[model samples]
Target: MSAVPDLNTAPTLDDFESLFVNNRDLDNVRAHLSKFNPIKTMRMARMEIRHSAILAWLLNPQETHGLGDKFLKAFISEALRGHPTAMHPSALQVSQADMMDTEVRREWRHIDILLLSPANKWIFVIENKFDSGQHTNQLARYLKLVQSSFSKDDFSHIRGIFLSLWDEDPDDDRYAPINYGSICEILEQQAVSGRHPLTAEVETFVKHYLEIIREATGMSEEQKELEKLARQLYRDHRRVLDFVIEHGKATDFSFACDSVFGEGLEHGNIVEVDNERFVFNNCDASSISFLPQSWHKALGGGKLYWNGCENWAMGFPITMWISLTVDADGTSGKIRLMSEVGPASDHEFRHDLINGIQNATKTNSRLRIKFQAGAADEGRKYSKIFKKNFFNVEDVQDQERIAELIKKALKDFRPEIDAIADILPKFASYGKFGKSGE
Candidate 1:
């Protein structure tokens, strides 16, 4: 037998690096290293996650790992035909044969991605969305800009594309909808066909990008293996990885939230749920209690904690209380006025609340109350009095703006809340029916 290699010496850092990088297939290296690249790991204004990356890749044909014009051509073809596959050879020739220029966030209009053909004629406007909904009439504004720039006769088809992870109908019918699934399919075709053969290095990069797009579109397999591998790697290098993550840049939403709510939390006006969650407790409370873990499990995300008057439930067979919830999530922030009656045996309590609301409506027209009659088995009956979604979570305004709005909403509705709290327990117990003894 040949001499046995020494197994006792621990591997050096360089040796480990070589073990991971050397003699490995290019695709494997790319798949493993893509997430660590500066474009992904570093924070930059121009990079909006995958949004800017997609545009940059499309714009630069001579850059490393560049996808040739065929991908752009295929995308345009799909936009024109309103389907995945091209109609015929002639469909590809709808635009000029050559790509002249590409611009991102072009002057005042600030279009996301703009592709232009030579002779200042044909233009293709692409608006890409990953998880965000379109702003009010953004597509129409873009269309108007493009129409005003070039006359109808000067260009072939001044096509507007709404490229997204999922198919969404554009607000304006003038824009065409195309999803990443079609783009992935076209890239896969190019990879396999070898008509425009890509070098191995570029092929690996394209495959890495395709996988990301596929995962976003929900076309790829669940990333269990990758997740498992990542977990193991993190486990092995917990100290180093933890330090990196701790110092790493926070996302746009996270940074904005820190700027908006951080001080309020420090001052105790906002209560913390976790790093990502907080509730504005501007509601003056007589009682506060932690929500049971089981309740959280059953209710999922919307409800978090509970607060109400201390003696509101006294002298009633069923527990009844009036309260307001300061609830928030990524999409919206709201203050909800509510009255809950637990163990609702029949629908009579709801009818009583409804009658009381109608009576209250005559005196207080601003009060909008909804009675939700819950089955006994459903655990609780609730009457919603006031619900206003005031601010969007995406808009990163100053903390003062959000705090002021929250304070105003709570203050404006205070009289109504106080009125209902005083009347609800009394009205729910004996409003419709006579006293319990009688």
Candidate 2:
């Protein structure tokens, strides 16, 4: 062990150099993490749909993974372990469901994974969310859909499983919550138990997936060791690490956004209105959102409101954003440019703004844009007034491509952009009573 450095002194150049000098442990950590994971290489590790598909394959007894109902049984057993009705006859029946007759369906009626065993009268609804949150009362809506879709007399044993990467309480209490950690343990046990031998290819794939789950859920032993070493390094060179992080290069996502929008704005390639150019400050990495200077002024100088909701990068009354969104199948994603009106604090103003835009679109064919209508009584928390997909998923990896696509989209949508911008100031001038109070 080396002697501990004094905490009272500021970190010097020597302290920073020591981090890379003869740091075999640091080198080992780097080498260990360099191992390839296919799930990550394809960029499917965090996709909820991919996880659901894999689970459906593994859970089906007829599927070629060769676990033959072992994984399903274990998963159900874990889900029902601490349930209030775990010992109920229906719950027990579900735990011991005949896997041979079970049919796993993906995206059935918009559910992530639905396992139906008509012979055993058991149905399992698994709602998997990897990186997103439950929206629109989805859990409850799924339960209601399932109940209405299936005949009660035929399917008496119905179980709803909320599967996620993190621990979250399901909106519907009847739905049992299960995390990726449980899935990791289950996979580890079955893969290593040797009771049911998987083919070499299947074994490799399972191990790879298990590695992904463990790393995501913080269950990997190697990851734990890496974290331990990292903490020790940080403690030993706290000042140096802090200094580097504070003044280091921007994050990859942030860099990409800045490169794209910053250059576009500088070159006058971005959309403009009334000589007012759109501005995108590198405030968030996940999405590039901006508004014309005049529109920002109209919306109370772009003050954030509502703290935003799921899938939204920023909270503003109205703005245009280009964000990445996953496809319905979850196999890939795309970048979409959209104009959104977020829930503003002033309910009356928000209501008037939404109506003003909707009425404008209805009368002027040139300004027509498809969007979900807000309630007449009040404004919705979030609404996309205009949307268009501009680039494929792989294009996001290249900053130049992102910049090119964004420029094209701005030019293509200039008419709609200008029309919407013209309507904003009219609504902004009206106060709580929808009369000119400005």
Candidate 3:
């Protein structure tokens, strides 16, 4: 093996070129990653909801998988291990109980998976998360909802399991933290030991699921080997890799947002307010929002209303959004320039905002604002002001096309945008009205 280069030295173009030439480790890593994984191929590998569904199928004793209650028992045993004293005594008893009559429920009361066995007086409230973290006191709320629904006298052993890809401490101590590694261990044992023999088809499916979980949790032998090779390669070409990573163009949704809106701002297409430039808030990698600075002042910033540009909407009472909605196949979708009123905590303010837009349309005529029937109702949170599909699905692949389409939409809606901007300042003084939490 060649001696590792000094990482302190700055990497040149020659160093970068060396990485692409005669790099066996890099080739091996690529080949390893190219190996077929059915879960990944179907695009169900990283989806948390799908993972929960698959787990529910496996955990149900009456399910067609034919593993009986073996998987369920093993799952419970693994969750309870090393933390018996911290858990309820009845819950500890559940590990030894017959789970053949267990009923698995997914998304029950918004919980990921709920397992109920009336025969054994046991209930398992499982909250599964693959990539995301628990938010809004969801763990506590789920446990509370389950307890209220299932009476303590009937279901004496109610346990909470926080199953995640990584070790995450649940907001509620009642939830026992369990990683996907435990799940892989259970599945591997069943597949190899043949304690409860599954049919050929069933066994194959289980093994496929096992492979996905192993890869996700970094438990697969192939993944471990890849990591080893990757580390070695990094050591060999540390300076070059560091330089590339530092100067690399981001290949995420945020990059798309930057390309479209950033260029629009530069080209004088997106309007600037009071010298405050439009800022893009990336709501995860799926969606992004660039709200005008005036909207920030009108909606009392993020503290009073919604935090971040959630659901592609910019401010609370009223705002516009340039949205990209992808289809199920993940390729084709439309880019829409849309605006909405309301969906705010302040109902009175929401109604006023909607009324102002509707009245503006009558005077200006060019505003072209229209409201659906019952939009002014106090109970209604969201009312569409206007929407225009500016870009087709085919235009999404080209960055230049996206920018051009956005500019055209901005030019077309300039009058309406200006009118809305004028009306927004009036609501700035509007105090918090009605109940919170829209």
Cα lDDT for residue 158, model 3? 78
Higher-scoring candidate on TM-score, 1 or 3: 3
Model 3 Cα shift for residue 341 (angstroms): 17
Cα lDDT tens digits for candidate 2, 254-288 = 56566654533432134443344775533455566
Lowest lDDT block of 10, candidate 2: 429-438
All candidates: CA RMSD in angstroms? 13.8, 10.0, 13.2
What number of clashing residue pairs does each candidate have, in the order they appear? Answer: 0, 0, 1
Tell me which residue pairs clash in candidate 3: 343-381
Question: What would you estimate as the lDDT of candidate 1?
Answer: 0.49
Position 35, candidate 1: lDDT: 58
Q: Which ten residues in a row have the lowest lDDT in candidate 3?
A: 264-273
Tell me the TM-score of model 1.
0.41
lDDT of candidate 1 at residue 286, scale 0 to 100: 19
